[model samples]
Structures are given as structure tokens and as C-alpha cells.
Target: MDVWDLNLRHLLAVARIVEFGTVSAAATAVNLSQPAVTQALSRLEGQIGMPLFDRRHDGMVPTVAALLLAPRIDAAMARMSSPYVTMSRLRALLALADVGSYAGASHVTGLSVPSIHRAVADLGTAMRRKLVERRGRAVALTEAGVQVVNAFRLAKVELETGLSEVAALNGQETRSIAVGAMPLSRARILPRAVTHFIRRYPMVKLGIAEGARPELVEPLRHGALDMMIGALRDPLLEEDLVQIPLFDDVPAVIARAGHPLAGTAPDRRELARYGWVVPPRGTPLRESFERHFAEVGIEMPKVPIESGSVMTLREILIDSDFLTLLSPDQVSVELEAGWLIQLGALPPELGRTIGLTCRASWRPTEVQRAFIEELAEASAGLPGALHPDLSPLLG
Candidate 1:
């Protein structure tokens, strides 16, 4: 049979039978008699030239063909049901048009009067003919208007339902926020921040991921991440990114409590005497350390153990004489527990700035903007954290 000959009612009946597992159950589900449901299924199978279900001892089992056709049938029914869903809306619009009452249309459609006028105007434009004609204060539909209204009546319900679903999905509660950070930040900063943010707005969904600065910049640039908080490496700061310096994290020498330098304030020469645990040579921290030591007339310390994992470094520091430079935040728990001790004063120049970064053009949505405000407030009283300097940019 051609597409138009396919009966929506019969297809619905077949779907129900397959869903409910028995003719009686299907009939009850669709508010029809068992015999009526069976007949509808039979007619549908006959129209398609295939048996849609097999009557087994267990229940009504759908055939392979029926299973394959079920999705299409459901989709067709959904589309067919659309116009009825919006019928009241279309009818009210038509009534208002007939009576020349914009206010009445607004009330009936639950839209503003201007929006009602715009919708009618848009419909007329789509039809390529005037649906409504105004004479003095009165409005009436033309011949083309009657035809358009009749056509719209068939699908208005479906259209309105689809639009409403889309609008609901686009609202603030349904929106997802993308957050990217270094693994350390994810383990430390993000958990507490996310907990606080969610406690206030439980409906806002969060998409959290962690990566190094190199791995994060592209995603942030492509609009994949709403914001990132991590070490502010210079190479990652592109023209498109807006970087806000949040705090300075100085790399301090960390070692187990009984290590040689634990109780001593080591001078630059004394620090260089031990084997070090450091990041790879080309990294920002490593480079910054080299620059600072060079300025202080000290040679770069030999790193016998190089690593990227902060946790691994912590483990080594807690159990070995290996000395490593680490962010105070990473070693805070160990330091507090007396498992590790700060060896010496970290030079002011060895400090790295951690920041909140986003796309330069990123305009925060109401929810995101509010969350950022809270983040700013929460970060304020953090010891050793500094407020962002905006005076230069503002000027």
C-alpha cells in the first residue's frame, strides 16, 4: 500500500499488542475491546501482506517484521497526533482573527498580543497569501486563510508540543556546564566547588573533565568547556581566552619529616646538594625554577627522579629522601599530618599563578554568572590567595 493508505490507528493497535503481551491487555491499554484490537492488528497485517504477531502459548509475540516496523509506526503516530495537540491554540488564533480581537488571541494562546500578531503575520507569509484582511477595526480570513487554518489544525498540537519540549530542554535547569582543570585541581579544588554549586542549584547538570594546559586550551577555544581552573601557562593563553589570575601557588621543597632538610631553612647552595624530584625540564615549573636559580647565581639542581604525577611524588616524598617542589595545596594534608615538611623558604619568583580561564567572548548565562560570583566569594578568604587585578584592564 502507498504511505497515505497506512492506517495510524491499526499501527497503534499493533504496537500496543506487542507492548502489553496479550490482546486483552492491549485492548485495555487503548480503551478498545479485545476483538476490536485483534481485528485492527489483523487488518494491519493484511494491509502490509505479513503476519505482525504470532499467537504463542505464552503471549502475543511480535514477528521480526513487526519489530522492525514498530519504531516507524510509533513515529508516524506521533506525527499524526501533533496537530491535535495544538488544536486549541490554532482554534483560538482563528477565533481572535475572526473577531478582530488581538487581546482575545493573546489570552487564548497564552502569548503576548504582539506575539500573536507576529505569528499570524508569519503564517500568512509562509502561505504566500494573506490569511487575514483588515477593514477599519474589523479583521476576517480570506479564502486562502480558511485553507491554511484547516491545514494548520491537523498538526498544530504536535508543533506546539515539540516546541514546548525544546524550550523546556533549553532552560537553565536543563543546561550543562563544562569544567576543565588539571588532575590536581579536579581532585582538590573542583570537588568542593562543585558540591557548593550543586547544593545551591541541584538541577544544573555538570560535565567535568580534567587535562593539562596543552590538552585543555583547544577544548576551551572550541567552546567545549565553559571554564577552566589550573596553572596559567603562557602558551595556553591565546587571543580568544580570558585569563583571570586567581591565586599564586609557590613550589616548596617537600620531603619526609626525618629527611635532612626538613627542619632547616636551606639556602640555595644547600638545596642543590640533594637529589631532586622535579617535573620534566621543558615544563613551566622547571623553566621557572631554572630562571629563578640563575638570577640568584645558583646552578640548576640535578633531578634524579622526574615525574608528572603529584600523588606519586607525594608517596616518594613521604617514604624517601627525594626532594620535590610541589604546590602547597597538593601537600597540605601530608604537611598537616607531619608526614612531610617544608624544607626552606620558596623564593618569591618561583611562584606560579593559578587562574580561572574562559573564552574571551564567553558571555556567562545567568546560572553560570551567578556560580562564578559565588566562586569569587568562596575563593576570597583562602590564605595566600590574591584578588584578581582588573585596574590595568579597566583603565
Candidate 2:
């Protein structure tokens, strides 16, 4: 069931009932009459298609479903950070904020344009802040609006996860994990992990979003993505995210198969002579490339084309003299097909620490945790992995 179908206040009442173990106490906490709380509990239980509490002479005894949902409701409510916000207002603004236009939001939500407008206005008035503003032909969130949307996004994730957890307990697989994949992960490890995961849990849905680190990080922070897999950053600056190093990806100096340096071991200077096409400066691969040259007393090659696309790099390397540094894992298929070949390998020091990144506060459900374990197993099987297995943290 869509979480939006449930009432925010009813969910809160159920959570309070779980906490206080009695309808009367829950009603007192939420400022509702005891009868109102009891009625709301009944309505919520009916909507959920399960009993949330067993009415008893001693006190309300929470069912298994209620125990599963209570903490999720508590976390979601905490993230929302406002008691006055209703489900209607949150849904309306999120649709508008994500779509950027009334027409787009209406198309997505199936709500009338007027209704979307009214809901957004209502949310702004309730918060006492302008949440949205016009930007040429579309709408944009003001700073206040962005903050509200982020909190709501996280709260939505929490609520959905809670519902899905309860469903899983009932033998229904209704949850999905969204993973942001950098280019390197897309090549071998991620596909392998996904295939194995699907074999084990065929009913669970998985969405893989391919993008550069810069493109993926914000979505991960906002709960749009469950995790990201790629090169690790040293001294990762973000306090809200944690990185797990699964393997060291050796940097390969790659070029077309028939190039002059194809079968030869070239020094950094020799490789630097040809123009380069590498990822933009900030990425781990790009940084490794910079280090390989400058650290050894050679000038860094000029990168005429900068991109995070393997397809673009492959095509450029195939037909031109442009060389690039990449993980062999990223171009294993091309290497096998002889469309591209590695001319030389960078020093081991220049290799990247590749692994997983996820929000520090994320609490994975059963399937989600299994996917992470699968990733560790896949990384261990990759060629030249430092460790035979990398799931000690999970264990």
C-alpha cells in the first residue's frame, strides 16, 4: 500500500500507543481523547490489513506488525522535525519540488494543478516560510524549501522501509534498494553482485543508477539512493557518510590494441607524450593519473577530453592516440575483446581504494543487508584483491 494513503496523525497515535502500552496514555501524549486514539488505532489497523494491538485487560499488547512499524514511525517523525506538517502538505510539496512545475507535478501525482498549488501554499503558511519560488518557466525551492524537502525525503524513506519490513515479515517482498554506481562498479563487481542477489532473492527489486560521484552523492545524502560503489576518497570529509574499502583497484594505462605502445612498457613520460582523455580532475582515477606523472618528475599530460563515461573513453581510445588511466575492472570486457589494451600499469601506490559508500545512519533491512554482503563477496572475487574476503565488518 502507498504510505500516502495512511494518515500522519494516526500513525503517530499508533506509535505512541506502542510506547505507552495503553490507548489512554497514548491519547494523553498526543492530546487526543482516549476514544479518539482507540478509533484511530482501529482505522489504522484496518488500513494496514493487520492487527496493530491486541486489546487486553492489562494494557494494549502490540502485535508483531506494530513492533516493526513503531521505530520506523518514530525515526520518520523525528526527521520531519515538525508536528504541524500533514501528510497532504508533505506529499504535495515533494511532488512539486521534484517535478519543478505545476503541470509536471500534476502529471506525476494525478492531482489537479490547483490542488498542488493550494497544498504548497498551505505548507508554506504552516511553516511560516516561502517554500517555493518561480524560476523563469519552472519552480525552484528556496533554502527553506530545500531543507523541508530533504527532511521529508528522509522521512519518506524511513516510513517506506518500515512498511516494507512489516510486509517482509508476512512473506511479501515489496521493498527495493537503489544503488548509485560509478563507472568502475558497473563493469564487473556490481553486475556480479546484482546477478547473485537476484538469484537468491528474486522477488526483491533493485534499481541501479549510473553516474559520477559528484552526481550521485547528493541523492545518497537525501535518501534517494541506498548506497554507492566506486573509488574511495581519503579522509572522506562528510560526517554523515561512511565508506567501506572492499578492494584496491589497480590503475591501468590503457590505449587501443594496435597503438605504438600496445606491447611495450612505457615510462610515465612516454605515455604522457600522447594527448589524454581522462575523467575530470576531482575523480579518483583522474587524481591517480595526475600523481603517476607529477610524482615521478614528469609533466602531466593535457586532458583535452574529460568525461566519466567508459563508452566515450573506449571509442576515443579505439580510434585515436588518446590514452587514459582506468581500473582494469572498468574496461575488462574491452580488454578481453581486444578493442583496447593496457600499455602499462601504474605504480601500486597510485591504485585506488574502491568500495562502498552509504549514509552512516542507514539501518538496512534483511534484503538490503544481504545485498551489501553480496557486494563484499563480489569484491573479494575480483582479480588481485588484497583480501580473500572482505565481509568481516558484516560478520
Candidate 3:
């Protein structure tokens, strides 16, 4: 069954039944008659395509599915008890979590201190758990609160997507996409795709957040990012994420223009003589670099700086003779502008399959899916876009 068919009341009834272990007790908790609570539980089971509870002589026995879905439903129900739970209440919780204080939330939301306090308290009461803890002068979200906050953020995005979809159906123009851009994408693929996307959907807003894999992965999982573009992991790291291949990104040894190593293929020992700039430790790029060096019978060169910032590395490369390893597409602009030169090419095994990364369960709206199509079209035109060997390797 789909999420849209899910009724909050039915979910709550199921949860309460599991909690109190009887329809009569659950009915009292939600202030409904036992028959009504039983009907709600039935509806919930029908919607989910499974029975959440077994009616035993003693009470209701929760299934494994009920156990798994209970916490999330409980968290959602905590802030959604009354029909009067308004957008303001949701905003208050988000703001409080963001700014870390009721006063700060009040300042950001332009709501009164009392209103913020009431909203936050009501949310906590609804969840039957304390969302925030105050240690005299400090405030922090409890673990349960953090889960609710993430779910609320996901709900907000879903609401926006619903509005955008309805607007599109009615011929109104409004859309937005949040993209997590990695190093390789910032250079060529992502920029080109964004340029094309805007031209195609001018009314659509594009938000880009740049970072390494570790920094971006959590956001994607939490639904804060629509999609991420960059080098795909070899083993496809997270079970909850899906990676779509677009093109092959091969690495190169790069140096400043007119550097002594610019036009020559230096031996491994000669390559080891110079100080280098490399990606931070524990990244795919760093691991690949190390593996490549090990295969060539040379130790990793001395690194003056470890960085993933293209601009920062470019500035350093332009003034010093330091060699840096990078995806060719990442330095396309500098190479074309004569600010950087490709000293040598890396082996094919050093290649990474660059593409899109998103939560495995993500269901993109029409316009959002259109942008993915645009990204694919953009990648098709890049040099060495096809890598037949990559399929087997990634597989």
C-alpha cells in the first residue's frame, strides 16, 4: 500500500492497540469506542496490506511489521494529536530544533515566547516524550526528538512536492530542486546539467550544497537533499541509497601551466619527488590514489596539503610546482583556460563511475525527474562518457 492511503488515526489506533494490548484499552486511550478502534485497526491493516495484530484470547499480539512501524508512527502521532495541530506548531518545533531555544525560535518565527513554549510542549505531549532537554542554560533535542524532526522535514518536502505537482497539473509554474554536488560534479557535469535544467524550467529554483561523501550522505538519507551528483562508490556504500551511472570519470596528474612536468610523462620516482595536493583521507579518491601508487611500486608522495576544495587546490597549483590528482572533468575549466595542465593520465582502474545518488525509496516529482533526465543528457555529451569496462567492475 502507498503512503497517501495511510490515515493518521488508523495508524494511531494500531499503535495504541499494540501499546495497551487490547482494543478496549486502546479505545479509552484515543477516546474512541472499542468497535471504532477495532475498525480503525482493520482499516490500517487493509491500507498496509498486512495485519498488524492478531486477536488472541488475552489481547492483541503485534506482528513484526507493527513493531517496526510503531516508533515512527508514535513519533508522528506525538505532534499530531489534535486536529488543531497547525502549520505553526510544526514550524515551532523545526525552529526550536534549529535555533536550540524557545526564545530563538520565537525570534525566527516572529511568534511570542508563550506561543513557542505552548507549541513545543504540545508537540512533546503528543509524542508522549520530551523532545528537548534543558540543562539550566542549554537546550538539545532528545534522540526521539531528532527522529521526529527528520520525519517532519521529510513531510514538509512531501507537502511542497504535492503542491508543485498540483500546480503543474493546473498549468501553474513553480518548482524547486535541492542537489548535493560532489567534487567531480562541480567541475563540469553538475554545472552543465543545472544550466540546461534552468533553461528548460526557468521557474524552478535550484539549491546546491557542496561537500564530500561523508558530509552529504546523511542529508540524502534524511531527505534533505533531492539527489547527489558525483563519483559513485565501488561497493555502493549505503543499503538505503541508490546510485545511477551517468559517465566514467578518469583521474589525471595535474600541475600548473608551464611547470616542468606539464608536457612530459614522468616516471614513478620522478613523480614522487614533488610535494602534492590530495583529497582528504578516507575518500574514494584518496584510496584510489594510494592503490595506484602501490601498484606502480612507489610510496605515496609527500602531501603539503590534503583538500577537496577545487578552488583552494587550484590556487595552490597555480603558484607552486605541486602535483595534484583529480578527475579530468573537475579541472576542465582550468585546463582549457591554461591555468592547469594534465601532466599524465591515470590507469583505467583509477576511473570512477560518476552519476546520481539518492535515497532508495525516493519518489521524485515529474519536474524533479525531468531534471534527472537533463543531467543524463548533459553527461552523454562529455568526453569518454561511455566506459564499457565500468559496468562489470561496479557490478
Which one wins by lDDT: 1 or 3? 3
Worst 10 residues of 1 by lDDT: 157-166
C-alpha lDDT of all candidate models, in order: 0.65, 0.87, 0.76
**Model 2 stretches with alpha carbons more than 4 Å out:** 103-107, 110-114, 383-395
Clashing pairs in 3: 78-126, 78-127
- In the range 1-395, model 1's lDDT, one tens digit per residue, is 33334444555677788788888887787677988888888776665566778999989988765664564445434533332223333454565654577777777556687877776776556546777877777677788776555444323322222222223333523445778877446544566777888888788777877766667767676456778887777666367677777666677777888998766777878878777887777566777667756777877777878776778888887777888777767878888998888876477767776768886655554456656655555556665567775332232
Listed in order, each prediction's TM-score against the native is: 0.53, 0.93, 0.74
Please state the error at residue 301 of candidate 2 in Å.
1.4
lDDT of 2: 0.87
How many clashing pairs per prediction, in order?
A: 8, 0, 2
Give all candidate RMSDs, comma-separated. 21.3, 2.3, 9.0
Considering lDDT, which of the candidate structures 1 and 2 is the better prediction for this target?
2
lDDT of 2 by residue, 154-178 (tens): 9999999999988877777798999
Worst 10 residues of 2 by lDDT: 386-395
